[model samples]
Target: MLKLVVNNDLHVNKKDTITCKNSCDLFDEITGECSINQGVDIDSPYEAARCGFFIHRDSMSVPEIKDHTHFKFSLMDDIDDDLLDDQEIFHQLVGKSIYKEEYTYPLKPDFSSYRDDAKWFVSPCGSYGCWIVNHYKKPLSIPKSKDVAERGWNNRVYKSPIPLHDHQSALPISSKMAWLIDEDGFGQYALLVNGKISSISAPKPINWKRH
Candidate 1:
């Protein structure tokens, strides 16, 4: 429903990969290597947008690092199975896994609405779900396949599962969703105190030590 611009402002593209060139400085967010030696077409800007926006939590509550919870975030179908029946390119939770070895928090706090502000969301496969926000910010990583040892950022699991309210859209939040805006306007991560995001950066790196 949200129209996010995939501003690859740098116009960054490796041999065949469109990567997060901007964020790599924070860490190598882009792949150092590619599956094919030749270049791959960047997901169409429209497709990219539908494939969803790279959700960056501009604000959130503190997480209870000590607690470990089982979140059903990986299964796109269970989240909206009817939509996934065609199985275009959406992820399937049936064979996927959740990341816990590092204790990531993708499942909690789908949004950081202080009271009701919501962020525009698209499933990695492009499904849109109802707005949500919990009291705190917990980074839970959703993984494909239940292999505990394989739970890490790499290995095609970095994309968090998108939650659709209904109707199956596996590669983009269909335009249909935006038209159904509920009373709340559903989402807007930009908190307007005077109309701007709070602009706070992570104070420090946290090691949850979650077993």
Candidate 2:
């Protein structure tokens, strides 16, 4: 019963409904030309994701974080949303050992342990970038809220101290712009510039929490 807050909406472990402009709708595999520039409808996110196009919100722009303290982190469970606006503020209260004593914050979470389900070459065809979804080896029992109507971004920033490509399990798509699908099968997107992954954005969800 793993729950994920993708694109600011809570989603269950099972496949959910989704619709977006897929590469198949725009790019002609045989012709390799832009056939249809508009969005194509799909009933499932996994189905749309397999086609290699995931919505990136309202814009294709990826904002740069000048300061590490300003990093926007994901706060699951019962946490104040205001703290997400300021990383330094979040660290002061939430990052303290007293708050996360029971939690295990590994040095670097294994991003590759998850199984790759699909990949896509992102472009202006969709929400500005492409994405891939990976499922974890096992399901997790994550918590969720009754009201799933919170509309916003819930992305966590994980800056690798060293280059990910240099690692033994270096992802082949390290040089490409793609979303980091979490164990729940939904996560955020990161920008790989000069082989380095920088600021990451939120991913699209099949359902948006409505007020």
Candidate 3:
């Protein structure tokens, strides 16, 4: 059965749970009045993704590296926890990434054929950037322990270089499943299938060992 390949130590079994916030929750759909860079101070899923949250360069499918017209770069924070009624301005100020397609790294792995369901592998962890690799013998430090918790931001950075051994044949699971990795301290990664834990079909640990 195709499954999400996560760290072996993550406590995500029948007893576990998960919650996925809507992409809009990160930043609402911007109309003519509000910009996409709005920020909410009361602790929201969108805070970390301010400024360029509206436009996306990376996608669950093959990336569109050249479609960067607005740039979507972060500028400054505009607090929205106070402006409950104001819709004219965004919670933050931002611009686009100055670099173009050439500067950006390869979104796909250097391989031959890609899988028909490559997008499905990224569906669960699309919100937070996820990189699939061929090998990781060293135990995952971030989300695994506090010693390297401070370096959690490096998840996308560190794994980025190690491209997936098989770009197309990623382990697939139903979109009904939602995943969350608590890197700050909980030291747990969860998967909620069909909005609840009861939906998991014989939850089991994934094989992340290098082939």
Candidate 4:
């Protein structure tokens, strides 16, 4: 079953509350007001990401528009319950929500090989430096909740859902793609380049929109 929690200006439930020190410019510190026109309800982390909400790093709660507390959480009866079983869905949500810089063409087209060429593309992981993907490294811990709306980011490379493929990730092509690689490295929903898989990484944070 899908679970939901609603929050508003008058009452903020601990389960649905989102807090950050300097996250949103739209929030009014004195009045506790959120100036955005966020909808009353968001059903999934995927949907929340599309709306530019982000998972707070410290709280590990469902991402929300800070100060835009008038929100209602509900399950979409039409969504397949089986799809919710995939923990990869949470990983996708984190990848989608975080802001990252992307390049259409290879950063260095003259690299000796596709593997070397792929390394030129970098993820501006917030204030951190380049995200290093090591094939031999273990995946970082992330929220294991099956509830899509409750998932949060864990400040690490998003692990691939498929076993033995932890270093790679998949995200939807939001705006562009310009080169082809001969490697299959992404999960489903990734934009294929010449029938090969591409790596995915989370970007920096995005601010909530103001009305």
Q: Quick one: best lDDT, which candidate? A: 2
TM-scores vs. true structure, each candidate? 0.19, 0.21, 0.17, 0.18
For model 3, give the 10-residue run with minimal summed lDDT: 88-97
Sort the candidates on TM-score, descending order.
Answer: 2, 1, 4, 3
Steric clash count of candidate 3: 10
Candidate 2 backbone collisions, by pair: 122-130, 148-209, 149-209, 149-210
Q: What is the per-residue lDDT of model 4 for residues 140-197, given as tens digits with 9 covering 90 to 100?
A: 3323422321211322322333212122221222221212211222111222121122
Q: What digit string (tens of lDDT, one per residue) describes model 1 on residues 9-92?
A: 676564334332221111112333111111322333332222222221221221112211221112112245464463421211
**Regions of model 3 farther than 4 Å from truth:** 1-50, 56-146, 149-211
What would the per-residue lDDT of candidate 2 be over residues 1-211, giving only the tens digit for each residue? 9998657555543333333323222233333332222233444455556532232333222233342222233323444677557543333222110122232112222122222444443332222323343333454332232123222334232221111111111122222344454443333455432222333444444464423
The alpha-carbon lDDT assigned to residue 30 of candidate 1 equals 37
Location of the lowest summed lDDT over 10 successive residues in candidate 4: 180-189
The stretch of ten residues in a row with the least summed lDDT in candidate 1 is 187-196
For model 1 the TM-score comes to: 0.19
Clashes of 1: 20
Answer with 1 or 2, whichever has the higher lDDT.
Answer: 2
Relative to the true structure, how large is the alpha-carbon lDDT of every model? 0.25, 0.33, 0.24, 0.28
CA displacement after TM-score superposition, residue 42 of candidate 1 (Å): 5.4
